[model samples]
Target: MGSALVTLGGAESVVIERSRVKTLLALGGCVLFVVGSVAIWRAESPVIGILGLVTFGVFGAYILHALFRSGPGLVVDDEGFTDQSSAGAVGRVLWADVTELGTWSHQGANVLVVGLRNPEDYVARLSAVSRRYARVNLSMMGTPVTIASTGLKTDYDSLFALMNERLERSRLRLDSNPPRT
Candidate 1:
């Protein structure tokens, strides 16, 4: 693992956090932009075509705005890895705190979920922040500790390796046949 300066709150879990509105606007905008552009091209009347073109611009902005809401950064320590940028946002859970570890792909991004013992509180917060992002997951353990990535950090392989190493050191192993679904 690369040597990195350990900062405060960089213990077992680290998360870069953000608000939900940002995510919604961003996703909705992207979809609208593409659809609108195509609609504008197919429209018969010039006025309708212009209106479609205008929607394309608005939607493009929404995508960008949503991207900004999901703060980007790396959250890792002895516990888990959080690939996020927002402050005070919970990221990953320490293996000592994790009961299950699973890696999956969602929304064209490879994601890892470290299931903790009691995860209700964190999961609730995550649900609130991810109104627009559809790639969230949750399952129960004892005291759930969790972490997620913003797909904006260094790399997934490196983070996974580091997290695994830390979890192994804690004697908490992932499932023998963890699904990569």
Candidate 2:
């Protein structure tokens, strides 16, 4: 079971760091894929090789970056959550804009899907590459913000519960003291 570091400062927050062990494992797998892709390219088809290189090679680079990168992968605070878990991460998302929280399964991995009231607002904040990926996520998952615990220290369930709790608290605060007009 994975656990997040919950800080009870002035404002409550959960900080989830990247799992070095999991990241190393992913990097190892990517290296294998790259090696296999190279072998296939030389012994099999150039087209397949190029495809594998393009795909796995790029992914390998990302994993490499994550391996060396420091700081928390995900941070859930009073305002919102910051996601640096994947290439398609959408920096930060406020609780007020989040409409719903749900889960999605992809290739046996459970992803925490955050439904926003105006998804385009968040989508527009991403880069061109991430924007395209976010669009794909929107089409398939009905939201652009999908948090996967692939390299994060916590699992999907833990992340979901923490976010749900924070969102609920934000809602209660908002209800008790409505925002001024």
Candidate 3:
């Protein structure tokens, strides 16, 4: 993942793109898994082969989509941040709505979990597949907006720091200038 601070008009935004090398490596692993599943079917057990195929196939499709998808995986701007880092990304989360920012570990991968005031609103807007993932995220992390740096250009720490900084700035701004009724 590559990240840049871009200024458009008077607003500055941080844009983080996906890493092709990392994505390709993940795709390669998926291919290997599928091949191994085939081998298992040929020699060992059809049940395990079928299970592996279904599991790895879904992952392969997701990785393929990420590989071909252009543009930044995550963007943090003046109003809010847009998360496209994963298949279940909850896009355009306003800083005002974010109640907390915390971390979680999922299968050894560090995940940045954003706590929202109205998580259900975000989950309702997601696609069916994404919604299922969002439900799981809510159950596991207590929020539906969980971002992982699996295929992205940045590390978990950097991503978390950037987001934390932005969220703080937003909160300070809001504190100083209260919304007029």
List runs of model 2 lying over 4 Å from the truth: 1-9
Model 3 scores what on Cα lDDT?
Answer: 0.88
Residue 167 error, candidate 1, Å = 1.2
lDDT of 3 by residue, 102-151 (tens): 98886788888899999999999999988987998899888999887878
Measured by C-alpha RMSD in angstroms, how accurate is candidate 2? 2.4
Q: Mind giving the per-residue lDDT tens digits that candidate 2 earns over 1-181?
A: 3555576668767788888898889989988998998998999898998799789888888788768876788888988898888777888999999999998886898989999999999899898978987998999999999988888988778788888999999899889999899
The lDDT of each candidate is: 0.51, 0.86, 0.88
Tens-digit lDDT track of model 1 for 107-174: 77665656666556555555444422222344232223323344233355765676676777556334
Better of 1 and 2 by TM-score: 2
- Please state the error at residue 138 of candidate 3 in Å: 2.7
Q: Which ten residues in a row have the lowest lDDT in candidate 1?
A: 131-140
Candidate 2 lands at a TM-score of 0.84
